[model samples]
Target: MHIPELYCPIPSSVVVKDPEAGEELIRWGADQGFFSLDSDAANLVRAIDIPLWTALAHPMLKSADDRSFLNRWWTWGAVFEMRFDTNAGQELDGFFEKFMDSTARTQIRILSNNPPLRDGEDFSEPMDRTLVSLLRETEQRFGNPWRSRISRSLLASAESGVWEARANYLSQTPDFDLYQGLRRHSYGQTYITDCAMMAMGIDAEAKFLRHPVIEHIQYLVALYGGFVNDLNSLDRDLYANNRCSSVIAYRHQYGVTLDEAIRAVVDMCNGYLRSVLAIEAAMPDYGKYSFDDQEADQIDSFFYILKMLMRGNIDWYEVSPRYNGGWKPGGPIDPAPWG
Candidate 1:
């Protein structure tokens, strides 16, 4: 396999994860049908090691034995399968779209302090009912805007999945601009970012989220995540004849070989990260918006967590058995160190 090195400035952390929490996640996911309780869960654990990856990628999850966070991570798999799994086909495409839309409305009403208009309308399936529990847990901690923000991110992702599915059916390849806008949600990084912000006590209001610097950082974080995923999962996507990948698109555009395409994608990830660095360099100590001492600390934590998320994501991809450890199949390239 050809595993091209990705360059980044943030160092990887060596934090250990809670095995008990990981096991509990497997059990819960089984009950939800995200995986079977036995071999399927074991294989998923081996391939994705999602618990470790979750702990690694989210700074707040590190050293925190919160099962709610772990459950939320497990629950997203169900959402991913429902929303983007190709085998789920147009059936889930429509079903999840309608379900998620209703879910959004429910979340809104809850935040607005309005009662549900009726019963059994919230969740049509047990698989999806977990989301309600997770939402309530989130509300108990971070109310209103954070919960609404979470709903928006999840809805944005569901909506993007519809577009992506249509593009796949039509054999259309998305340009960088179009993909950049949707990839943040379609790839589910925006939801992850939202949860991170909520956990860190950052304001989830649009004013701060849409602040130019913060927006750019969030976009780059998504881009970094998307590009790295494309780099590692190129093998799987290629096998599925999926052309919605930056590496594949670059290859087709330039008529380059797969190895060359992979290398170019690595450069793309580096560019995204360097842009994030530049945003940090230009921003004030409190970032795009300023506030009191406590708020300043929260904002600083946001930046710090952003850096950790970027670094930990790459680190997880590097070590995970998933997507063949993020390598393209060709056996032993230089494995040369990248910047």
Candidate 2:
């Protein structure tokens, strides 16, 4: 399972303050099968004391559905771990429950709809029963949380927007420019809201959303994360016929080889990283926003956490089965070390 070339070593600057936290994180990953790697999966586990990562464990343990919990954590927990503190994590756990419940309600509502049929054709047949059966099974497997009708509508609308964005991209012809492609590709749920919550912890929504600089930070972080993914997912995306890649877009626009396209992407990512770092350095003294002392400190912590997150993406990419030659159906895609 090892790929020396794919490996992105953890930097000393992006560190975990507590050894126990690091061990628990690694253990949790193993228990959850976060990667298709064996016990000696340290390379797959990057150490960043993201308090939010720790916070999720409590809810996860209490969850009736381990798979659903694992899916959520496996998807975002790796990235979240790099930047958040303990209090931030706790705050996020509360938000995570709300967000997941909202998402589930949205999903349920979508599934509840009847599929459009041709004129003069009734869908009240065996398939309709089958669909209802499937829906019931899904509901039973994953219990629904109480969500207000207004909350459901809002979440559904948000989900619809993402669906529209993706559909719009797929409907378009190829040969999109880098910006267009990045916007389309990077526009999915990247937990930008949750990231901001790291600073505010509780009641963080209004402050983070209202702040002018936050949008810029969000855009940069999304682009940075998106580019990192586009770079790592070159092969998988190509194989899966997902061509909305920034690197591929660059190649189409410039007529370069894949390697050259990769280099170009790497350079762009590094540039974004530098920009974020510069922002981190300058944010403290900027004094434009009416940030209270606590808010200011949180913002500073966020920037630092962001750096680790961006870098940790590179590290996680190297080891995640999702990127490595590890994903396969109906089997342990990669064998454990003992085997």
Candidate 3:
């Protein structure tokens, strides 16, 4: 689904000026049926510009020696940029800075609040300091001083209570078993972390959707998206991370091969797509200017683009890889049955 041309009637001009006020406005918009929780979630997801930019900016990830990986990363950024609202793009630069700072502060506080898990152990202090320093260094390297500041503040504020809640949620529920599985899988861990951060951003911004139901939906979408991307990059992820994805983990435990594993992952992703489609359909009708239609179209366009890429009809530079890793165009292959 290519992103639809529908303009979100909610004024970007007003929202972009102040994030707190913008969040309130988003909630109001949702209540009035001008938007859905998913759309609001999408906006929060878009705000994590740093991670996306990091994937683009990091030399290790974007080596000129590996043109395919660099090109694919660029393509992914382009697609996201194409779909992102212009105002949202402008707001994100600042929002990302504040967000990073917030997360950094929170991480620091959490580390300080927790005691060592073992005798004569005190890795938390040094690890927290190292992460803070790394965050600063990353921002400096990227020329984002504000991001560094915000990251420091964010991590400092994230204390034991928050950590405990997150830990409890991950440990206590079958609902979050997929997340735990992802955490256990090396390649899948990035998705879990990214989704957790995205969910936090949404909660921090729009307070109304902080409920478990909303968080669970966001987690599901993120997990399934990760599954799809992992299936698409199975060979690359294995080579780069020396670990298979959660889907592969499940397969190994149950005894399945590459092809069978791919099918299972695809089926799971398709189920997520169906759920997304249903949510988009249920959104209140907004005459000819429907946000639901716009969302549905974007989903359709993404699948269409995936189809084209699978068929090798799209230029390698035109379709981007969603996750980090190197790629070799037409290296070793299985002809996709979807083609």
Top candidate on lDDT is 1
TM-scores for the candidates = 0.78, 0.51, 0.36
lDDT of 3: 0.34
Residue 76 lDDT (model 2):
33
- Which of candidates 1 and 2 reaches a greater lDDT? 1
For 1-339, candidate 1 gives per-residue lDDT tens digits of 485677787877877766676567667676765557665334444446667677777656533645357445545543343344442223433553574466544533543435643454565544446666666667777786777777677667656766765665456777756765677777567777777667766877635556676777887887788777777766666655665777777777778888887887788788888888776676675453544444556656778778888888888876666544433333221110100
* After superposition, candidate 3 runs with Cα above 4 Å error: 1-180, 183-207, 237-241, 283-339
Model 3, residue 64: what's the lDDT? 31
Clashing residue pairs in candidate 1, if any? 1-331
Q: What is the lDDT of residue 35 in candidate 2?
A: 45
Candidate number with the higher TM-score (1 or 2): 1
Runs with alpha carbons beyond 4 Å of true place in candidate 1? 1-3, 33-35, 39-42, 62-68, 87-122, 253-257, 285-294, 324-339
lDDT of each: 0.63, 0.43, 0.34
Better structure of 2 and 3 per lDDT: 2
Which model is ahead, 1 or 3, in terms of TM-score?
1
CA error at residue 327 for candidate 3, angstroms: 3.1
Model 3 agreement with the true structure over 1-339: per-residue lDDT tens digits: 111111112111111122243344344434433336465332432332223322322212323323232222222222222221112213343443453355434444433434322433333433343334433443454334333333433332232123322332233222224433443222222222322232122122333234353345444554554455455545543343313254455555557775675666666666654664454454345213433343444333332322222222111212333222223433212111100
- The alpha-carbon deviation from the true structure for residue 81 of candidate 2, after best TM-score superposition, in angstroms, is 21
